[model samples]
Structures are given as C-alpha cells and as structure tokens.
Target: MSRNIYAFLAIILLLLQNCSGQKTDTKFYDKDFKWSIQIPKDFTKVSAKEWAEKQQKGENALEETTGEEVINEAKTIFVFKTDDMNYFEANYQPFDINIDGDYRENNRNVNHALYQTFRDNMPNARIDTLSSTEKIDSLFFYKYETKIYLPNNQILDIIMYSKLFDKKEFTVNIMFTDPKCGKEMIDAWKNSKFEK
Candidate 1:
C-alpha cells in the first residue's frame, strides 16, 4: 500500500512540476515597436546575420517564382523556433501610402481574405477565425487557428495574431507541431503588452 501511495505521490509531483515549469519568464522587448512578450525557454532565436541571409534567399526565390520585382517592406524583429518544430515569428510591414480602407481593418481584412482562399486548396485542413478582434496590449488583433490533419495521424496547428497601427501592420504567427508548445505560447502571449 505504501509503495502504491508513493508512486501516486510521485506522479502528482511530476505533474505539478511540469505545470509550473511551463510558465514563461524570459521577456523580449522590441525597442522599435515598444512591444514586449515573454518567450518560452524552449524556443531559440537565430542570429540576425543568419536571419537576414535566409530572408534574402527566400525573397530571391519568391521573386524567381513570380517573375516580378519583389519589394520587402516588412522588418522582421524576431524569429523564435523550437526543436520540436514549433515556429514563432514577428514582423511589421509598412502599409502602402495609397492604401484605402479603415486603417484598423486594412491589414486584418487582407489577411482574412487571403487565408480564406487557402481553405479551398487545403481540403484536409480545418481553419477557425475569431468572429471579433481580441485586444492584446494596445492593439486589437485578428486571431486565426488552423489544424491540418495528416495521413499518418499527425496534426499541425497554426496560430496567427495581427494588427495595424500607424500605417504599419504587425503580425505574429506560431506554427505548432506540438500542442503543448502552442498552449505555452498562447499563455505567454496572453500576458503580452505594449510598454509605450
């Protein structure tokens, strides 16, 4: 009986440790945007040089594929990724000077239409968009969640948060191959704030 009790206690303790361990404390501040977020310990950010090189390579490939001049107006502030295949990226894009529409809905509307189009090509994927904007910090972000079911019984989930401010659109996206990581990120982001 005592052995069984000890085993149960050990399991309970382990669960408690895991729950407490998942709380994020490491904060990343973006001086340019005056934004801050607590990042999970499991994610690692690559060096700026590497990021720039990769960004250029990707843009080059995109330009080659489209046969058009590709201009990148977005500045990527950080890209955090985990070994478990979860990806988190943050960037801000300048709105075209001649862009028309409500400033608040411009970026969100474009992304909504674009993502809605993706549903037609992905028959096996389930996508969910929030009916209303959720305010995180100083911006009201349009939220989206996607789940892709694979043939081998695996799943990939994607979360997107976006908002427009002062003629610039800011976006944060997280692709989670691990549900636990997604939960952690969601929790961390819930506490996000604009310090300015």
Candidate 2:
C-alpha cells in the first residue's frame, strides 16, 4: 500500500492496542519530575524506546503527520518530554519559519501568529490558546481541523498543556488528532504519565 495508507493502518492498530488491554502504569521523565499515570485501555502507549526504534527503522509508523495528508488518514497524537532547554528554545523561538504555506517571518506579522501573538500578549505568564498554522517540523500544518479540499487535510489538536510543577520553566507538549475520534485521543493524553 501507500505510505499514507500504511500510516493510517498503523495508527488504527496502535489505538486499538491501547484500548484493548487493562489500565497500565505509564511513566515519563522530565527535568524535575518523574511522573506516573494510570492509562485507560483506549490509548496506545508510544514509549520513548519504541519511538526511537521506529525512527531507526525508517518507519514513520506512529501516524503523526502534517499538511494535507491528515484528511485521508487518521490523526496522530505525540507526547514526548525534553529537558534540554535549547531544544525547547529552538522550537519556541520566533524565526523566519515556513510550513506548508503559512509563514511567520516577523514576530508581528503572520496569519495565525501563535508564537508572536502569545509572546507579546503574555510576556512572562503561561499562555495558551488555539489557532491555525501552516507549519510543523518546518512544514505546513493545519489547525484543529483539516483545510477544505487540501490534499492532506489533517488537523492537529492540542489537548492539554502543563508547565513543570516545581521547576516552573519546563513545558509539556501533548497533542492529538483524529477526524471523528477526538475524544479517545484526548483521553489518552489527559491520562499520560511522566518519569523523571
């Protein structure tokens, strides 16, 4: 089959795997906290080890995709923790980045303006809002839902956000998307755990 079809099937299988078993103890690590959560049987546990293995195998099998491909396949959710401030800085910093067709060259100009607008609006406070963007991994990405008639009309939904409880400097990124299966994906992220 095609790569997109393979991705979609893998996602479905992962979801089913997550939903089939009893609640499992999930663990994740951050800079300051080693967290554990009881995950329901409906969300697949994409362990760091497994993710690494998949990457090594050259199999984009976890179902996370941006741009117009999401509409044809199931949406994917990814949860990973990074203690490296430099990585987060690179991700959040404003630069002349382009994804799909959305562009944010200036901190003041752009269509969605998430990075710029949020920083300007809440200089020192934790900020959260939902908006559309045409960028992910330096490529274009749609917002909560896919754009109409786009070749890959997939929408990435940010379900939850939590800063480091004690450190107050670290951030947790939890995002998921499934055309009509949003609730299932969100529940998985909500019940996720982290290990320090």
Candidate 3:
C-alpha cells in the first residue's frame, strides 16, 4: 500500500474515533501553536487523547497499513464536526514542511509526489483540479478535490487546503461523507482565521 494512503487513512480514522458531542459556540485556541478557529454552537469538539484511547481499544485498522506508524501526538487541535455527525466541518493542524531549496518549487514537488502516490494506491480514484494555485491574503495555496471510491461503492469527498509558510505548513481539511456539504465546507474554510 502507498504510504500516502496509510497517512490519509490514519488521519480519517483519527477523526472518526472517540468523537463526543458538545453544545455552545466555542473558540478552539492553541496558544503554543498560535492558531484559533471558531467552532459553531451546534458542532462538537473533543480532545486528541480521547481519540487515542479509542484507537487503542479497537482493532487498530491504522496499524495494518504495513508498518506505517500511527503517531498520536496529542494533537492540539481536534476535529470539529457537524451536529448530525455525518461530516467534518473543519480541521486544522500545523506541520513542518520540508521545503529544501526553493519554497514554491519544493512545495509543488511535494504535491506532485502525493498526487502520484494516491493515484498509485487507488486506481479508481477520481481527482478534480479545483485550484492548482490560489492566493488568499498573500498566501499561496494549492487546493483540490478528490473522490475516493471506498468499499461497497461508498465515496468520500475530501477537499484539501494546504499553505506553505516559511518552513512550516498549515492544513485546513474539510471532508464530507455526503457530497452535498461541499459548499458549506468551502464557506467555513474561507471564514476560518489562521494566525501564524
């Protein structure tokens, strides 16, 4: 199996595990990470510890990814999902982007690598080029949508928004088990504020 699929499955399972519901509008803030996002009153927000416990209690499908270690690093930002629990409204995480020489060129190379990896893993995968290069507030992002055909003919729509800042990258991921939430997810992504 491709490592990208393993990484992607790990992230999806991490999001789906040990999810609990919460009321009241809340602002998710991580002081050390210097990032915050507004989670609506109807949504639910939980801790990464809870998800870790859930993964440990289960069969751990992520571990079967052929030696791809699942690193549950107490993620500062947990997933924010809709009230119905059908889709993820918004998720934020910061990563150390390995941009070796030129930032833009390296970033493009990284994207290309991921694209090829995903295609290699899932031959039936349908990818759409939403925005190869989109700028927002002086930030350049490569955005795209992909439809992965799962077992039993179920399809998952994932819209990935990634930005390279200095040597770090911040990803704002929105997923829909049902494709109808695409517009709402895009709106939420646009309204989200990321403080560097």
Candidate 4:
C-alpha cells in the first residue's frame, strides 16, 4: 500500500510539473477558420471583442478594426504584441460570396476580392505587391508589403499575407519593426496550414 502511494505521488508531481511548465510557444486554432498557427511565447493573443472592451477602458489596448467590424465571423481576431507594442493582428473572416464554377476559377476570384478588400481597408497605406500568387501544397497565398504612415509621423513597414481555404480567408498583418521577430512572424504565417 505504501509503495502504491509513493508511485501515485510521483505521478502527481510529474503532472503538476508539466502543468506549471513555462509556455515557450503558443498556438491558436479556430475550427470555423479551419486553420492553426504557432506563435512565440512573448506574443499575447486576444480576441477582437475582448481587445475593444479593454481599449475602451484603457488597458492592454490594441486595435485592428473598429468594434463594429468585430462581429460574426470577425469576432475572434487575434492581436499579438510584445511589451505594449503591437506587432500584428491575425484573423479568419468568412467569405460566403459564391463563385460560378471550378475551384481554381473561384480561387482566382476570391484572391481578387481579398486584394480589393485589403486595398479598400487601407486606402492611405502605400502597398507593394510582394507576390501576387504563390501555390504551396493545396493553398494559394497572396502577399503585400505596405508602408503605413501613422498619425505620429512614423512610417511603419507592414506585411500582409493572406490565404483562402474552407470558405474562409486567413490574414496575418505583421509590423516589420524588429528583423528577428519579423522573420519569426513571417515564418509562422508561412508555416500555418489549414485542414478541412
């Protein structure tokens, strides 16, 4: 009986250790989006609604879209930053606009729609198309490098990488401030895969 108790205690300790272990990496997954990506420990993930509420109260503030846009399929927008500096916002928004025929044809139309949306969203930002279309595995991606001038007269370099799958579109907009962190963020975006 004493030996059994000791074995159980050891197992409990191991479990507790694992539970208390520092998270050096983090992953965010959404079934509706049918996508997943691994991010670093320093980046904090917050939903769009949660972020807006906190911002209204002046705490841990990050803004992606207006709170009005934070509805329905846009609800779970994930904001990531380090030390009060926002690096990017990642989210998947549903695209229910029907395409006529083939998957390839629909994909082309979807890509064009996504690109138009991006431009419409950031009318002032100067955009440079890094790669219009690139195929990886079963996914086609569109990338943009934009220079956005903030109100404070600061020019921010941003990367907008997007992909469409499972009737939804995924976007990762990363601020290219720190080269190392920027590379990691881009790699995370590229490494992201959707299963559906």
Candidate 5:
C-alpha cells in the first residue's frame, strides 16, 4: 500500500509539472515603413514572403472583373497597406444599389457569404472590436472577433483583420480559426518582421 501511494504521488507531481511547463510568448512581425502585427503561437507561419509574391503576381488577374463582381467577392477581413485602392475604387464606384442585399439571397456563394448568414441568424452574435494596440513592428492594425456557425452546427471562433504598412506599399489580411490560437500566429508574425 505504501508503494502504491508513492507511485500515485509521483504521477500527480508529474502532471502538475507538465501543466506548469507550458509557456506563452508574444511574437511580432515588423516591416519597413509599413505596419507590423502580432501572430499568435498556435498558428504555423506559412511563408509570408510567398504570400506577398503571389499577391504581386496576381494583381492583374483580378482586374478583368467589373466593379459589381469585385464588391460581391470583397469579403476580405484585412487590407494591407500595399492594397491597390485603385482596385477598390474600380469595384466600389458610385452605385446607388446595395451590393450586399443583392448577394445575400444567393445560396451558391462561398464560405464568407455563408458565414455572414450565420452571423445574421445568431441570437447571441456580437462583434468585439480591439483597438490598435502594440505595434507588431511598424504596422498599425485593428482586431475583431465574431462567433460564426458552420453548416455542421460547429461554432467557429474567428480572429481577423488587415494590417497596413503604408511606407512599404503593402497590406496583409489574416484570417484564422480558433481565437485562442491567434496568440501563436501573432507571435510568429512578430518574429518574421515582414521583410519579405
């Protein structure tokens, strides 16, 4: 009986140590003349340089659409500083009609539209706006969270927004699931410094 008690005590102590061993660190991403941001630790940093390069290459691909199509597809969570306002201007020109109203009735739209519908239907849905706090590097940003229901009844907690680096003429939009995991992603972004 004494040996069993000793074994149990050892297991309890090990469990406590394991729990206490977890650490949380704040990571930042900095860019020259542009805004910086924080990437949480839970998320894996998926090559910021590659994303930027893709954006640069795809700039002209989106130009073929008319203004109306652009507005319909512009469910962007964040807009970086390098975002071409000309694209926005071309897509959101002075049209007296409500673009959302026209698109809201369509069931064939993508996940963003579906998420919007879920948000509208939720009785407890709320938007928490975070002030621009703690510059990741040089970028300025705002963060917001909203709980959205998926088609399977699973609730998706999301953190999203755009970071602007005006001097670098670049902008970054980050969208992620699990708000708790955002801390890690924010940290990775901070560590990367957004130079690429």
Candidate 6:
C-alpha cells in the first residue's frame, strides 16, 4: 500500500477517461469560468466507459490506502490524451470558503493537502516544487508540481493548477513524462486566451 500503485492507477483512469473519438481541434471553452485554452489538434477525448472503470480503480486504491472512500463528486469538464501518454483533464469540485473567507488561500490549502497525501502514503514520491502562483491569461491559479517514481523505474510528472470561480473549484491537471510534451503543454496553456 505504500507503493506508488495509486499513482499508477491514476494514469490508467485518466487514459481511459478520455480515449474516445472526441478531439479538441482548436480551443476549449467554458462559460462558467469564462475561460478558453488552446490545445493540440491530435488530442483525443477519453471515453466515458473507460473513464468510469479507471476512476473506480483509482478510488478503490485510495480507499485501501486511506481506510475510507473519499467521495469523488467532481464532474469532469473534459479529458484529453495523446499517444505519448500525455494527458490533460479539467474538473469542477466543491470549494468551501474558509473561516477567513480568502479565496486564494483556500485554493492553496487544497493543493497542500493533496501533496501531503502523496508524501505520507507514497514512499518514493518526491515533491519537486510546492505551492506556487501562476497567472494564465486573466486567471490566477495555485499550482502544485510533483514527481512520483514508479516501480518500473519510470518517472511520472504531474502539474496541477486550481482556482475558485463563482465559489467552485476548477482544476486543470497535466500529466506527462516526456519533456517535449511538457514544454508543448506549457506553451499552449500559457498562450491560452480568456474570451470576453
């Protein structure tokens, strides 16, 4: 249970989640957040069936580790992947305003909890970088970057950004082991536009 199996399960779930025939083509838009991001044309959407199966596996793995089922009520906005194991997924989950009523601080707290879980449970996980702030287009996102060493001697790099929009949490998860794909993803996300 101290192994990085949960991390591997996550990869399977994400790969299955958006392996459908759907493609981003150009820009992905969301009216609730008033946001749009540029994505590569070659990305394919994850199938619902695959997403569900993989998601459950991930949840089961978590339950075994934490001794409780953390309910996943987050609704996926989209999940896209390429043949290179590069993935991008967006989801919305509940965000409770803290007692201090600070939006960004609350966002940062959520990211901290996730990273701490990785450190506490996964033995070989290395937290390359902790919480940082980055402004993409007009949105300010609290970022968390981590590198998890797999049992097969491969590295899994994950970059996650979260923000609160209208009192809800919106997150973008980018997972890639390839350096080239990571650069490409960073460029695409950096150049994304927020539609007025």
Among these predictions, the greatest TM-score belongs to 6
What range of 10 consecutive residues in model 5 has the weakest lDDT sum? 84-93
lDDT of each: 0.56, 0.29, 0.50, 0.47, 0.28, 0.65
Q: Report the C-alpha lDDT of model 6 over 38-98, residue by residue, as the tens digit.
A: 7877777777666666767766756655665556666777767775368777777665665
- lDDT of model 3 at residue 120? 52
Better of 1 and 5 by lDDT: 1
- TM-score of candidate 1 relative to the true fold: 0.67
**Number of the top lDDT candidate:** 6
Question: How are the candidates ranked when ordered by lDDT, highest leading?
Answer: 6, 1, 3, 4, 2, 5
Tens-digit lDDT track of model 2 for 1-196: 1122222122222322221222234443333334333333334445544433333222332223312222222122333222111000001111122322222222112213333332433345443445444332232332322111212443333322222123121222333444334454344434545542
- Root-mean-square deviation of Cα positions for candidate 4 versus the true structure, in angstroms: 15.3
The 10-residue segment of model 1 with minimum total lDDT is: 1-10
Poorly placed runs, candidate 2 (over 4 Å): 1-36, 53-150, 168-170, 179-181, 188-196
Please estimate how well model 6 matches the true structure, expressed as its whole-model Cα lDDT: 0.65
Pick the winner on TM-score between candidates 3 and 6: 6
lDDT of 1 at 15: 15
TM-score of each: 0.67, 0.30, 0.60, 0.54, 0.32, 0.76
Write the number of the candidate with greater lDDT, choosing between 2 and 4. 4
Q: Predictions ranked by TM-score, top down?
A: 6, 1, 3, 4, 5, 2
Report the C-alpha displacement of residue 25, candidate 5, in angstroms.
19
Model 1: per-residue Cα lDDT at residue 38: 86
Candidate 4 global CA lDDT score: 0.47
Model 5 misplacement above 4 A: 1-68, 71-134, 149-155, 166-181
Q: What overall lDDT, based on C-alpha atoms, would model 1 receive against the true structure?
A: 0.56
Candidate 4, 58-159: lDDT as tens digits: 111111211222123333356665433336566555554464234344445434433343355546655444445655436776655555554455455556
Q: Give the TM-score of candidate 2.
A: 0.30
Q: Tens digits of per-residue lDDT for model 1 on 1-196?
A: 0001111111111211211113234789988678889898867764555555455544554334334545566677776666435666777776643554565455454444434434543456665554347778656787656566654566766666766667766777676768888788787787888975
